[model samples]
Target: MSVTPEAAARLRAYLAYFRDLGVHEFYRWSEPAAQALEPAAAVEAPAPSIAAATGVLPPATPPVVAPPLEIDDRELQPAHMLPPSLREPPAPALRSFDDLVPLPATTIPAADRPAALKVIQDEIGDCTRCPLAYGGRRKIVFADGDPNTELMFIGEGPGADEDAQGLPFVGKAGQLLNNMINAMGLKREQVYIANIVKCRPPANRTPEYVEASTCSQFLIKQIDVVQPKVIVALGSTAATYLLGRKQALAGLRGSFHSARGAKVAVTYHPAFLLREPRMKGEAWKDLQMVMRELGLKPPVKQ
Candidate 1:
């Protein structure tokens, strides 16, 4: 019988496997051996059997199932995942409210030296604690004189001159104030001068009720700190701020009022003297009253 090319190749492979199993040659023992192998030889040979008594059987292999390929869906998205270079920086750590140190209270202690002045200064700088803060320049003109002085001159709010210089009594009215101080035989430094409201009203108008109320605390604290034997409230606003009433200046003047437990006397504002220069006589009289109350010498006649 003739063998096809495929059968010849199968026979070669089977022969090679038999050689590896130490079977160099084969001989047919009987007709049954030839008949039994003939069908297998026509097809691919079975793998060698471990036992020679048993016929060779092909090795059974399990079917291999490959894993499905992963396709990234990001390419189809409108927004792409940021590359390492394009990634955002980490946000800064937030500070905890608990971690913040609380600021010390700014309340002025009664009769404390520079501490009281410091409180006044700090309050004056940004004193919105009152409505007056809205209508004036950035700063409130707190008094600038001896904080320890026994005499204090309390005035109304700042005028054009006082506001510009950040000092009390620096205009024509301030000139008059200096004359009045000198006439009473006292230097400006010997007396401490302040205003009811540290800031000036618009167009030198009288301070409003709300503004005066706001600045009242500062004036009271000032009185406590100065511990002055006598206080001269320079105008109606000053009188109102100290006394909490808007009485006529004439009635309020020439009388004693209590301010932070100190003796207070109301008098015309220096600016009022500018408007009514004749009032200087009355102002001088008020200054004499102040001197007499404080045991100071009376003004010498010119």
Candidate 2:
């Protein structure tokens, strides 16, 4: 049967959902054999006394026939799109950043990194690669700051302010981030910044696994081109995707992780700091670890 465009779109969504759940393969079940008319059909029939008692069996009764079952293709197509909750096995595992894609064969020379990053951006133009494209994202907030910088910051995803401006970190959280950057004795333009997903999730919600995984390819490429000496993962979401594991932020912080040929440090997102200002000290500690690696020191007060 031919699938209409609308139906095909829905099918794609269902498939994406299942793919995120880690169900890559599906198999068709064969139809069950028709049932017998008599309950004793399997019984060794009392020596077939009644029917075979005589060659003259009473006109030989015919076997009952069952009608074919009608199924709706619309409802049954992609029948394996069941929720993971209903399945016996756990959902598919999340892949870490390194597993998402390999680094480019060769590093981009410092002089060419800008143009190299632009190429990746152009490839993602008007992207509809994931559900986020349709989730009311006004603009795609690509990476900001120096392409050749040795330090990069990765956030969860775009927020409303960033989505509207097509630039990362312009809102209140961004302001806090700017302060954090300054505290590290660096200018905003001296460091690169990006997010797990470019497009903003609906209502600024965290990105879903499918959305993050789909959008992160470009991010991986961005990381490769920039080839930062260190990447600071801001928040649990960023850490989850970068390190490719699910762990509490408390544990992930205060230590160095690795991703895409660079050292990774986990910290509280600026947004999180806004909600819990007390944690700013802890976040600063994480940044200090990054600073020490880069040999950076806070600026002297006037």
Candidate 3:
């Protein structure tokens, strides 16, 4: 059976991420696995790290000898596409809202989410399904982060650098976000970052009503894939859509709201704070709520 094109696209995005992490060299796969799943031709670099500029990792896992990464081509194919003799048995049905959180109650067994998320990304392939597709944009910026992370950040859409690089953030605004995450005693890779729409709107404008509505389904799927303990809506665009209504950021900014079964907090965009640096303090207040929720320590003053 052929691996669904949808699944293969994600494999590319996923591998591209590993490539960015500088850890791709630690492993290798057999030629068939490489040929079957190589997304090298499709995706460029993994979505840039808009959360943390550089990772703060635990001591590296001691290297151990292992068998060559040789996966069966049959395993790559989705069950629906496989022949009767090759098709594997279907797994048990997930309980209602099971997809919202991990099995056994929002914990371990992230349910192979990386692969599932890759499938979702593929489903959105070369997305001409909307008017936003036709733009000076080079590539669609899907998302960035560990698929199984516990904290997430969602913003409006791709900006100039983001569009050019095919990654979210990665501009002056992204640098500010990096500082925010660092202040919370967290690393960028510890949380997930995504935007409402994958494509960049013309002239960096806000995504249209139809655009946001259409791209939102993918965002919901992304949220479910991450199962975060809390999500910080990075601006009014993020807040308005995540909560599903038009409202001022003032009314929505100070407290926790619910969306896709995750605790949502609204805050100003980094780009806004750049123009109004005084507001960084206010943004910090919102981020502090995120820290408390995650039981993170405040950065001690030097």
Q: Rank the candidates by lDDT, best first.
A: 2, 3, 1
Best-performing candidate as measured by lDDT: 2
lDDT of 3 by residue, 108-139 (tens): 35868888889899999999877799876678
- Model 2 weakest lDDT span, ten residues long: 32-41
Q: How many clashing residue pairs are found in candidate 1? A: 0
Error at 28, model 3, angstroms: 67
Q: How displaced is residue 185 in candidate 3, in Å?
A: 0.6
TM-score of each: 0.59, 0.72, 0.64
After superposition, candidate 3 runs with Cα above 4 Å error? 1-108
Summarize candidate 2's per-residue lDDT along 195-238 as a digit string, tens digits. Answer: 99999999999999889989988999899999999999999999
Model 2 deviation from the true structure expressed as Cα RMSD, one decimal place? 12.9
Question: Between which residue pairs do clashes occur in model 1?
Answer: none
Off by over 4 Å in 2: 1-89
The residue-by-residue lDDT of candidate 1 on 9-71, one tens digit each, is 566566666566566658334776444435334557676558634765567676443333454
Measured with C-alpha atoms, the lDDT of residue 267 in candidate 1 is 85
